[model samples]
Target: EIEAVAASNRVEVKPIVMCRVTQVYETGACVYVYYGVNFFGVDDPLQLFFSIEQACVEVMLRHGAALSHHHGIGKHRKKWLPHVISTPSLRMIQGIKHAIDPTNVFATNNIIDT
Candidate 1:
């Protein structure tokens, strides 16, 4: 599904599966996908990367996959946090961030806006 999404956007990706990092459960399994995109002849490579990544994330979410696993959600994925976490939960996280770093000194804009 992720590969299809990337291809639909005219992006070519080489996906490598990290089997050792995969987690298995009775209900389902979580596999880590490490992919490299070919940006040859692209004008705005960064924008293209973001577009493919966002589309892949949406596909994962639609298929009942978590927003993130061991890897934390950084600024790149913060915009979609609300879709995975509840409103109150997001508020609690923001409040915690405000409490710890009132001036937004630590990892500014890494996760939540606060």
Candidate 2:
């Protein structure tokens, strides 16, 4: 069992790095790392890494656990069909992308303006 240390009135928390392995990678415009420390359903047999931006976004939106252990929203996993470009924040993002790219080279879905 782990012992607790006390302060004025609250117990001081000590961080424990409960991990086995970690690796890092870098690509065109991004760098990513994989931590092999995990629990059930996270069948990470190999410690791997990817530096692709698309891959990073893909994993986060798809496999990586979210607020309530939900799936993805991209072409791979979640595959959500966004009919409407809802919200002012999203509109702002579209506007910004259009302002920068304007040619729609990195165009995918949802953000049609880009």
Candidate 3:
């Protein structure tokens, strides 16, 4: 999938897949796959890099992977949140966020938006 994305985006690079050599914790069946895009030179290449990376993320999400593996859902990935999580779950999360950060100082953008 990564290769296909790269090809379609005209990114001349190979996909790099890395796995942990040791177990850090017992996550059971959950495994997080991280995709990093590094490109040098011009602005167009950088933009293409981001586009391809987002495509990779879409593929992962379609395959039942989380929108994010480390950090919680931020503004950039919020569009896909509704598809991944239920409406009730999102409302509950927003309630918790409001209870904890009522002042909206956490800066999650539209992450808590219903």
Which candidate comes out best when scored by TM-score?
1
Candidate 3 lDDT over 9-83, as tens digits, reads: 655566575544332456434455555544443347666666766776788678876776557767766778887
Give the C-alpha miss distance for residue 19 in model 1, angstroms.
Answer: 6.6
Assess every candidate by TM-score: 0.74, 0.27, 0.68
lDDT of 2 at 72: 22
Error of 1 at 41 (Å): 2.0
* For model 3, the run of ten residues with the poorest summed lDDT: 21-30
Residue 62 local lDDT, model 3:
81
Report lDDT (CA) for all predictions. 0.73, 0.36, 0.67
- What is the per-residue lDDT of model 2 for residues 1-114, given as tens digits with 9 covering 90 to 100? 011111111324431323222333362222233322222232331221121223444454474322112232343322222322246765687688788877767745535522
Better of 1 and 2 by lDDT: 1
Q: What is the lDDT, from 0 to 100, of the residue 102 in candidate 2?
A: 77
Least accurate stretch of 10 residues (summed lDDT) in model 2? Answer: 1-10
Error of 1 at 5 (Å): 5.5
